[model samples]
Target chain A: MLVYLIRRIGQSIMVVAVMATLVFLAVFAVGDPVAILASPDADQRELEAITTRLGLDRPIYEQFGIFVWNALQGDLGRSFVYAQPAVDVILQRFPATMELALAALILSILLGVPLGVIAGLKPESLLGRSIMTTSIFGFSLPNFWLGLMLILLFAVQLRWLPASGRGETVEVFGVHLSLFTWDGLRHLFLPALTLSLYKASLVIRIAQAGTREVMLQDYVRFARAKGLSYNRIVFVHVLKNMMIPVVTVLGLELGSMIAFAVVTETVFAYPGMGKLLIDSINRLDRPVIVAYLMLTVVIFVIINLVVDLLYAAIDPRVRLTESKG
Target chain B: MSKAVLDVKDLSVSFRTREGLVTAVNSISFSVGAGEVLGLVGESGSGKSVTGLAVLGLIDPPGEIDPRSSIKINERELIGLPEEKLRRVRGKDVAMIFQDPMTTLNPVLRIDTQMIEAIRAHEKISEKAARERARQALEKVGIPSADERLKAYPGQFSGGMRQRVAIATALLNRPTVLVADEPTTALDVTIQAQILSEVQQLCSETGTALVWITHDLSVVAGLADRVAVMYAGRIVEEGPVSAVLEAPIHPYAAGLIGSVPSRNKRGVPLAQIRGMTPSLTNLPPGCPFAPRCDYATDICRSTMPEPTPYEGGRAARCHHPLSAPTPAAA
Candidate 1:
């Protein structure tokens, strides 16, 4: 297990390096951030000063080397727009996005797993078919549109909840959280709901598939024959087996959830890393943009590594095979 | 004589398919007394395994047990029993050991968890007590170092050992009836013989009725006190093992015995039953085996024959049974 962890960490490092290099080159290849940062009427000399100040005048290779070195030192360069270190700016907004993602993930598991199991257990039943039909909307409807529809119905028409923004905040353990405040929870609901719908659908499909497949396995039949109560058979036998694949999907989805939150955050005007990313992109904040992309990539790689470890934990067969390697 | 532990009467199992209603098992009746081993012998698709599942009330939707059918364990009706009551009876009253031991035990769970869970399902025993029983059960099945083996997962065990664990689980609660659905089919001959004897001895000691479902006549010849030969979805012949193996009355049963390699001359091609199994969805009005029976007559094709007593408590579902001068006791 120690060797496996060490090997996975090594692979993760290589993956992160490749991603950083690619993003560095891609950001540079795009239209210059200098134009967006500089005044339209700035003279050549003024522009040159700004360009050199930002290290734009340096060769691409040298710029990339400096970027890699700074990244290794835990410094993503200063944001052109915010005039602050990109890492600090992202960190300040990370909590909001994390909160939203976590809530959405919790909601997805709470609603999707049970519903998926029902659908799988009785695939031809009326309730199962209806759950499946509704989930298709979750998969197909765009998050932005879903967000808008929710805002229109709940905020504009019904006025049951706030339309946009993270509401009032409370300090707990030296951290300001919106989840505790009533107004903040009300504000958090719409965006989180819209965000979770799509993910919940994905969970439903995965869970249903996993449950159905495991239900046919010999062990399940044996469990039933052993006279296990329906509850025990479903919960202990079927659920444990089904969770292996579901956990893999959820781990991978978490990274994408952060990535996809950009549109959702923008739609609801939620103060999160995704919204910050959008603003940074518009203002030509190259450091912030590069940092965001690299962070997401690293997160994805780490999540996959964790997922591999979880597979071994969940299944002895996998553990045996992994040990042999 | 010991009381009958399982009494299945006119039991039929059918599945609702997109094409039509497919009868997997037609009206079949048999009983296994306590300490008795009844071998349900049939080829693939012969509904032998379905009968075992139906007895356990394990058939799910798309597959339905006929309402009129009756399956009683220790005189308690199993068919149409409520799920809650059936659950109480399951594992406690009757348990099943399935085919493919490699897959029958949950791959993720330790042997102790699976075995103890089976015990605890029927008995409200302490975990420690359950574990003790599980260890004893494993030891009874010839597993060495039973205490250590209990901690290992099913994937860590070999095929034969896994089957032993499965057997241990079934016997954990000392169920009144134990249905083994070809548990050794995936094992080697030596392992198969070992398991067969061990299971037979265990059942006799515990007085648990044992139904060994298999397609191998030779397996039945050795392990079973009585044998019932199934063709398609019906039992074509049933008698004491010695009688059935020595002289089968039904043509299909005779053909099955003949198809066994040991029955033929060493140099000759083995005898075989002619024709494929009739499709359950579109079976003829008469006997399902009539189309394949060499002695099939017009009467055989016109009407299905009910099981009839021949001699020595033997029965066969046929118009004309093979004549044997000697009569044997059950």
Candidate 2:
């Protein structure tokens, strides 16, 4: 087991290295770094100074080495556009996006899985068929479009909630609350719901297909023959078997949530890493772009690792294989 | 004879597909006496597994069972029972072991979790007791280190071991009726033989009415007390194992018996069934096997014969049952 874990950790390090290299290349590959510094008002000396200060005057390899070293040492350099520390900029904006994505994920799992399971168990029933058809529509509708629809219906028509931002004012327990937690959740509802619409459909389809496949398995038949209640069979036996593929989808979806939330974030005018990354890209903010890209890579790798661990917990066979290797 | 443990009468099932309502199991009647292993032999889509599934009320929706279909276990009608009540009957009074052992056991769960779940599903047993019974059941099925194996996942075990675990699960409740649908089909020959003998012994010892559904005639011949030959959706022939194997009266049965490679002596060419069974949808007029049977005549092709009793506890469904020319002697 120890040997297996060591191997997996070794593989994880390699994967992270590959991801870092890719992010570095992608950030630099888009356009000339010196062009942004060269403006109509800037003279030759100013251009040289800006280039030297930003380390663009050095060899590409040296620049990349410096970037990696500083990134590893918790120094993400300064944003070219924001003129603030890239790490600070990311940290300031990350919580809002995280809160929104987390809410969306939770809602998807809560609403989509059960609906999918019901649809799969009774494919011919009116409720089941209706749920399936609605899920298909849900999947086809884009997140940004869904966000717009929610804004139109709930924000414009109903006036029940604010259209955007973390809320007008923040207070908790008769005290001024932080925008990161309570206020963020209040303002995040519409965008989160929009984000959840597509994700919920995905989760439903995956869960439904998975549950359907599991239901057809011989063991399910065995369980039925054993006189296990329909509820027990569906929830206990079928759900457990169906979770393998569902977990895989959920994990990938979670990783993609940070990236996929770009359009939704833009629509809501929300302050998140996704919005920060997009703004940085538009202004050719290399440092902030690289930092955000690295963070996205980290999130993807970390979530996948957590999912692998979850897989191990769910199935001893995977654990055994890990141990054996 | 002992009292009938499972009495299935006029059981029929049909699926509402895009094409039409395709009949999977026609009105078939059979009874399994307590402590007797009735072998249900058929090829793929012969409705053998469907019949077994129907008995437990496990048939999914869109596949409708005839209202007249009646399945009684220990004189209790199971057909049309609500899902809640049916759950109590299944795995308690009647349990099934499916064909693929790998899929029969939940892949993600440990043997202990699955087995104990099965045990506690019907009984109000403590976890400790359930665990102990699971271990005992595994041991009973000849699995070495049963306690250790209980903690292992289904994928951790070999195919044969998984089948043993599945069998152990079925026997955990000491069900009155045990339906094993090609349980040993996925195992190696030696493992299949071992499992077959073990199941046969367990059934007889516990007085459980066993229905061993398989395509292997030889396996059933050695294990079952009585055998039923299903063709398409109906039982074309049924009788004592000895009577059916030694002298099959039905043309399909004779063809099936002749097709067994082992039945031929050394240096003799193996006999093969001439044609495939007719499709369930758009079946030929009259007999389902008429298109396949070489001995089928105008009368055989025009009229489906009802199952007629033969001497010495045997039955056959054929218009000219005794008219076939004898094959070269073995």
Pairs clashing within candidate 2: A225-B91, A226-B90, A226-B91, A227-B90, A227-B91
lDDT digits (tens) for residues B1-330 of candidate 2: 578989999999998888888899989988999999899999899999999888878787678889899999999998878778888888889989988887888777778988998999999999999999999999888999888888888888999998888888888999999999999888899999999999988888899999999999989889999999999999998889987888787888888888788734778988888777677888777889988887788987788888777765667678877533232233
Docking class of 2: medium
A15-50: candidate 1 lDDT, tens digit per residue: 998989889988888788888889999999999999
The candidate that achieves the highest lDDT relative to the unseen native structure: 1
Which residue pairs collide, candidate 1?
Answer: none
Candidate 1 lDDT over B163-235, as tens digits, reads: 9998889888889999999999999999999999999999999999999999998899888999999988999
lDDT (tens digit, per residue) of candidate 2 on A1-325: 6675676678878887898888888878888656765787888898899889888888879988998898789887898766799888887777668777888888889989999899888777899899989998888887778888888888899987668776543545543333446555667788888888888898888888888888888777777777777787787888887888788888988888876588889889887778887788878888888788778877887788788888888767788777666
